[model samples]
Each structure stands twice: as C-alpha cells, then as structure tokens.
Target: MTRPWTVRLAAGLVAATAVLTGCSEKQEANETLPTNGAAETTPELPPLGPEDFPVPAEAREMTPEGAVAFVRYYVGLTKFVAENSLDPEPLLQLSQDCRTCIRIAQSLDEDRAANRRYTEYAYEFTGYGPAMLDGETAQMGFLYVQGPITVVDQAGKVVTDRSAPTPVELQSGAVLLWKPEQATWVITGLTVG
Candidate 1:
C-alpha cells in the first residue's frame, strides 16, 4: 500500500531549487492580504516528544556534538513548520545548497500563497547516528523520522493525508559540510526513504 504523509515528507537534501509546474499563478505582493496577529502566536500544536530533540547552542557549530544537536533541532523545526501556518523565510536561510530544504521552503511558500495549511502533523525519528567526519565534511548517518501527516484548507477541511512508517533501515542523515571561513556547519545533504 502507498505510504501516508507524502505531502508531509519533510526530509531530504535535493538541490538548491525545484522547478515544479502546474501550480497556480504566483500572487503579487499587493494582491496578497495579511491575517490578523492570530498566526503570530504559536498555535496549540500536538506536543512532540520532549526528549526526542536536542537543542542546539548556535546556528553553526564546530564540533561533532554540535552537528548532531543541529540536525535534531533542524528536524524539529521542519515538523513545526509542517504543522503550522507559518512563514518559511527563516528556513531558507539555514540552507546553503540543500535541494530538499529548498523544495520544502518552496512548497511552504506555495501553501501560503494558496492559503493552505497542514494539521494533525506528527513525526518520530527512528535513528540518529553519530557524525562521520571526512576532512571538513561530515556525514551523519542513519537518521530518519516518520509519522502521519495531514493537510487542510482555510475552511478546516482535510486535503491530503499520509502515514509514514518506520523504514527497514535509516535512509540517510543530514550531510553537513564545515566551512572554515564561516566557522559553522552548513546542511548540504539529506535523504528521506
């Protein structure tokens, strides 16, 4: 059977940009209206397992522990974005050349432009391995999250629903390449499924 939560597949490290067609025309700056401060305050989302995520000290870190913390934080951030009607501008900044991250940001932009939202969103990481360092580039292995994901419209109607099951093996974790000049790790790679 087809897995659920395809629309909510928030893991991957494709390329920098996605060229998807068939989407509605882009909305002009003035044409888009803004909502009141309702979305500003965090909505009452389902509580994610508190112990599952490790907070990061900074956006960029130089150590292996920092890298793992960063990945965990990134995963949590993506899940939050998926479950709430929020802006994706910040996520774009975290990516350097990660295609998956770009695609997710683009998809969020599209959803916002169309006044769409996702709900009943949940995910769980099955594996989070240590970082495999190769020179300045580090490859974090066996990291994956899977769960049910649902989308809804402004009217509170379901649009798409999918359930992601734990995979036989962890697909791939985030590929973080260290930039000495920047003094931080940039997420350059990720793979889901």
Candidate 2:
C-alpha cells in the first residue's frame, strides 16, 4: 500500500538525514580533532594595507630599470585605485607632498562621497621614456592614454561624460625619490597634460 504524501516526505527526509549523518561521522573520523575537545577554528588573516601592492623586487634596485619598474607599478596602483574606487590612502602613501597626487586623491574621495564611479574607461601607460637618475631622485616621462570616460551616480545618473571619439593622449612625467629607509620610490613631483 502506498503511504500518504506527508508520510513519504517524512521518510525521505529521515533517510537523507541518516545519509548525511553517516557522511559527517566518516568525515569526522578522517579529520584530526583537537585534543582539548574544542571545536576547530580557522586562523584569522592579518588586515590588508598598502602592503597589498608591495614594491616589486625589480623595482627596488637603484637603477634605471628599477625606476621604470617603479613608475610602472605606480601607474598600475593608480589604475587600481581609480577602477575599484578604493581608499586613496595607499596611493597617497606612495607620494610625498605631490600636488597632482593630492588632487587625484581628493577627486577620488569626492567621487566616493557622491556615490559616483567610473565605467568603460581606463588609463593606460603606453610607453615609458628613458629614466634620468641623479643621487636619490629620478625623473621619467610616459605616454598616457585615457579611454572615453563615463561616470554614473548611485541612481545611474550620468554625472560626468567625456565621450572622446578617440582616446585622449597625455604626456605625463613623475619625479621620484629613493627613500633608503623604506627601500622604495616616492613621488615628489607629478605632472600630466
């Protein structure tokens, strides 16, 4: 005789529970439980900070190649900040009293506050010119191409639109200082046309 729908459903659930319990027991047997009879917990990870975008070993050497690598990394960090709309503190930490850097950070902060974000546009460093190094300072020129930009607010309202039929090209330069203590390059001057 066929059982009632409710009774069959109950039986199915009981069977599933038994199977699951058996699997759990097997898994427990395979695992090494704590000797103290306490539940195991995963180790917590350290908080993320500027170290997330660490200076590459190549960028650490005090050489022209190192300067180029450092500049590349800096541009990459800038792109990361702009694309993710993340805190500009990391970018600021890489610079020392740089007016353009401060302006970029302030713009990011304003965009965040206004709930505006960039879409369908990115900044790319096309090429890096020769790096000039003197003592603790280095200067380099780079070709920057920015794609057509579109910014939208929280309500999807177009806040700023720069629909350049062609990507806007700018000649940018940066002056970096080799900080011995931090073993990194810090931007002291920045300019972008």
TM-score of each: 0.60, 0.68
Candidate 1 structure lDDT: 0.62
- Per residue, candidate 2 scores C-alpha lDDT tens digits across 67-173 of 88888887787766766778888778878989998998888788777777776556678547658999999999888887666677888776644233357889999
Q: Runs in model 1 with CA error above 4 Å?
A: 1-55, 126-128, 161-170, 180-183
Q: Looking at model 1, which ten-residue stretch has the lowest summed lDDT? A: 10-19
TM-score of candidate 2 relative to the true fold: 0.68
Tell me how candidate 2 scores on lDDT: 0.76
The top-ranked prediction according to TM-score is: 2
Instruction: Report the lDDT of model 2 for residue 65.
Output: 78
Clashing pairs in 1: 4-162, 4-163, 5-162, 5-163, 13-190, 14-99, 14-100, 15-99
Poorest lDDT segment (10 consecutive residues) of candidate 2: 43-52
